[model samples]
Target: MNNLTNVIKERLTKIGKDFNEKEYGFLNTDERLRTPVLITLGGSHAYGTNIETSDMDIRGISMNSADNILLGKDFEQVANEPTDTTIYSFDKMTSLLTNCNPNTIEILGVKPEHILYKSDIGEELIKNKDMFLSLRAVKSFGGYANAQLYRLQQKSLVALTPEQLNAHIVKTLNGMRDMLEMKHDMKGIQVHLKDGEIVVDINVNDYPAESIAGVLNVFNKTLNDYHKNSVRNEKAMNHGKISKHAMHLLRLYMMCEDILLKGEINTYREKEHDLLMDIRNGKYLGEDGRPNKEFFDIVKEYEVKVEYAKKHTYLPMEPDIEKINNFRKRMNLRMVEQITKRR
Candidate 1:
């Protein structure tokens, strides 16, 4: 194991948060409503950005009983918060994948070594991951990055200047992309100074509505946060994790752009390690220890790239719903067959 990997594993044990499969006793229920299928490292560790202070997150999928599938009983997931473990039912997992949800989607692409356990069905699930790739990613990933950007903006130690406001709009525009095109036949939305006031000209038609709403939601929250003014600024002074949020904000854009542009999941972020670590370590922070324009400049670069990709992306307009349903049935049928043999 690498030194960093050892440190992370050792850190988990030191904090008394280390775990084994046996510790997930919910898996032992008589009905087998949540049988383990796959488990993998999550959060920073899975992304290869974990530091010594990073917390461990274990995420996975579990196969549900035949009755739960056929009869529609409610067995969604079990959350062991103290241990930071979350395992979703196979059905729940498939549903989430249909939307290309970032959190659950990444679980399907974790590095093999990071995957602690996998049954035959789990392997098959990974093999068919491409079925879930679709244009919905334009909304899913960009939305996540926008949410992160909003959080970073919220806890800023100062009020938003016109320039900073421009950055926010641009970053968010990147996240929403052509989705905003629906709003106004958006030729293109760009934040610029008209007499020292931030002005956005949106030109779009038939863009994605949900993604546009997500951008507006974030902007509203940020505007409200600005209203808090000095009180929020003071609180921001003590907030050291803003850098981490900033790093993730940029990283999400990178990941999403890759998904839209290259048609890949890229969970570990091996090639971008140095740049991501620099951001995480505050290389892009200004004297106030807040994310500076330099970081936003980089974010803008990725945003432009993602826009170009959105127009020419090779991914489908939606997931292969029929295929996804078939795979779920196949996995669940194997699950039912297991129960039959046991009987």
Candidate 2:
């Protein structure tokens, strides 16, 4: 273990009870506070872009007791403030894994030194990490990127009119639809961008009508909201928020592109360190405190790269569902056995 990991472990063990009381206002029993199967640094630290002011965010997973699962106890996750530590129950983690959640998946890919703690179960989970990756990454990563882009655009500008917000909504929705069709082999559905409006056509027989309708509903609701409220605050741009979102926007693209092209996630971000740090440090912003033209150009470049990676990617159109189901079953059985032994 490295010095950081050692320090984390020492703090958790030495002052765990007091810390929990002060931060969460609840005391964990010894059984509930024992060794976690995995613990790793999260956020910018895991991505290797931490500045001196970055807070240490820790995430972990621990096995749920037999009673907690079978008996339907209320255990799902634990949190302690100040230290910013959070640990999810194994059951909840598995559910998130099935969805290919970007945050949870990164925990399985942190660099060795970033791993503050681990046990045999955690080692096994890391060894079998590939089983959790799937085509779902396209949607998850793209959705996250779109969210960051939305935030960046929203906060970087001094004022945003309803018309502009409507345009952004349409663009985001169409982007989401394109990603879904690219990875899922959907057919007979069309999304069009025209005059700052989104036009979608769906062949009800070829696609789930409800899903298509859901998208339309979201678009309609957003349009209605914009029409209702026409003006927004005209305050100065928030450079810090813009910088943070800008960095994450590129990071999400890089992660998605890597997963598609290389069939793996590199949480340490060893290759994109300098560029990511520059973005975090406001190198991409202009004197007006807004992202410059060069920033948009970089965004366009990554978008094209992600598209290319998607087409040439060796990954299948869908994950090996059978393989993943078998793996999950085995892990569940192991959890059952462990819980039984404790009983």
Candidate 3:
């Protein structure tokens, strides 16, 4: 572990009044902090993709006081800045877990070294992590991936300034290349690249001449836009955004694919370090701040894998709801017993 992460671990354990004063006014006293059910590192660190500049993110679950729950006092979660830590109440955590929330489910799969604290209740929760896995992961992971794709598209469109406009054009052309290769039969088409200029030629023998003309017209317009704006601004390139979104887009697909194929949640990306690190470092991104052809090919390959996994997965059409409910009842009963013992 690095020095900064070590320091973060120390500070997270010493939950002070400043951290709780605004978020948890009900916890005027230090009762809640005295015994948290679980605490673990999250985000890039937990996923094993941390760089020197990565922020420390911590997540945990704490039991609510009987009075707080019984009286219907609000204590759903607590978020503290500087460390970017958030601890959800046990009740809220369980509810989210049942829905197959990506954030909450990830807590169950954190590496042992990343676990700062874990009580018996927390241990039990981790042991029964499989209870939370189901077909629901498909929707959750897919939704997140779609959101990332939307953000990338939105970012590509809003180009007011000249620099931003040029960047947008570059990104659009890169996407066009990927779309053409993936969606269309490339046998009749040939792409030529020279001095940053791209030309496409279509064989009339393989494809209808009119159809080829329509495709070429669209490509020509895009090329025209790029030449008209012809100025490049080094600062306009959003390498960080490209790299971050690219990494996450691939990661989400990988996670969902694993869930469908093996019925397991693997949060750590140790096996994909080389590819992930390259993406994170912008190695796969073009000068336009968009992922290159190779990246799109990988995405296409994973899409096929996930489709196959969905059809062949051993998981049921839905989660075993009765088994999950039974587990929840037992955990709640244990919580009640603990409260009674305290009283």
Candidate 4:
């Protein structure tokens, strides 16, 4: 345990609370439920963007217990909600890391002092973190940034102009087939936009029932999301939300650009603290409580750079799934070994 972690534990313990308090006995103190392998600093502290009043966030990964594995029950995560602490099961963590998830990917690259605890398994996980980096970072990080921007824009991702809406429909229609059949059958479905109307031509045959069901499911979900995103948030116009979310919007873009351009992860924005803090502190917000022109102009510049990096980056289209699966199997076997030893 590090001094910072000890300080936190001591502080909490003194106040009639502990990290493994009654309700959270499953934390480090329990063997039947979960056991954390790595716990690191998260949120503003990890990003070097914290103020004096910033909340503490502790994030970690836990190995699946014997009961979880053998009982075939799902054990995804345990959280200390009040403290913003979360320990994800190893399997869930692997799933997220495999997709180059923006939030979890940063875990492997936090400054050393920020790492509160790490076991041998955690060390190995970190060593192979590079295996998780891929072209997916562009989409994952960019999508997250867009989500933040949506809050600031008071709009949903599905907010589209007349032409954009038609284009979206065309794209969705083009994918309405099974993964294998989509490639060969996409040519059969031709969609065209004439003046403001959509014209579609379907000349397909022998559509599998399963694929038809899959398309219906996907289309239903997509339509629901579009309906939901069309409504704007009333509170997004507030200054606090605008500025804070704008800061994150730019941060996400920066993080994505870094992964694409540098091929390394550095979560702490030490050099950009001034710029990020200024944005968060409302320096870039206008008198009307909206993000100012300067803010959007800055964001636009980053957007262009991110797009360029996305196109030119050397990263592969996907992570090495086979290698990642092998590593996960080894970890699971080790966990079972430890459990057997206790037995």
Candidate 1: regions farther than 4 A off: 1-34, 157-159, 162-230
Candidate 3 local distance difference test against the native: 0.67
Q: Clashing pairs in model 2?
A: none
Query: In the order shown, what is each candidate's alpha-carbon RMSD?
Result: 6.6, 5.2, 12.6, 5.9
Q: List candidate 3 stretches off by more than 4 Å.
A: 1-35, 70-74, 158-239
Per-structure clash totals for the candidates: 10, 0, 0, 0
Q: lDDT of each structure?
A: 0.74, 0.72, 0.67, 0.72
- Please give the lDDT score at residue 154 for candidate 2: 64
lDDT of 3 at 66: 61
Model 2 scores a C-alpha lDDT of 0.72
Residues 4-78, model 4: lDDT tens digits:
345446544553433534443445454422456787878988898887777778788888887776775547877
Question: Which regions of candidate 4 deviate over 4 angstroms?
Answer: 1-33, 70-72, 155-236
Sort the candidates on lDDT, descending order: 1, 4, 2, 3
Candidate 3 per-residue C-alpha lDDT over 94-145 given as tens digits, one digit per residue, 9 for 90 to 100 = 7677657777888888777777677788898889877777776766666566
Mark the 10 consecutive residues where model 2 has the least summed lDDT: 17-26
Using TM-score as the measure, what is the rank order of every candidate, best first? 2, 1, 4, 3
lDDT of 1 by residue, 60-164 (tens): 888877677678764788787876878888898898888778889999878777876677898998888889999888787777778787677767736586577
Q: By the TM-score metric, which is better: model 2 or model 4?
A: 2
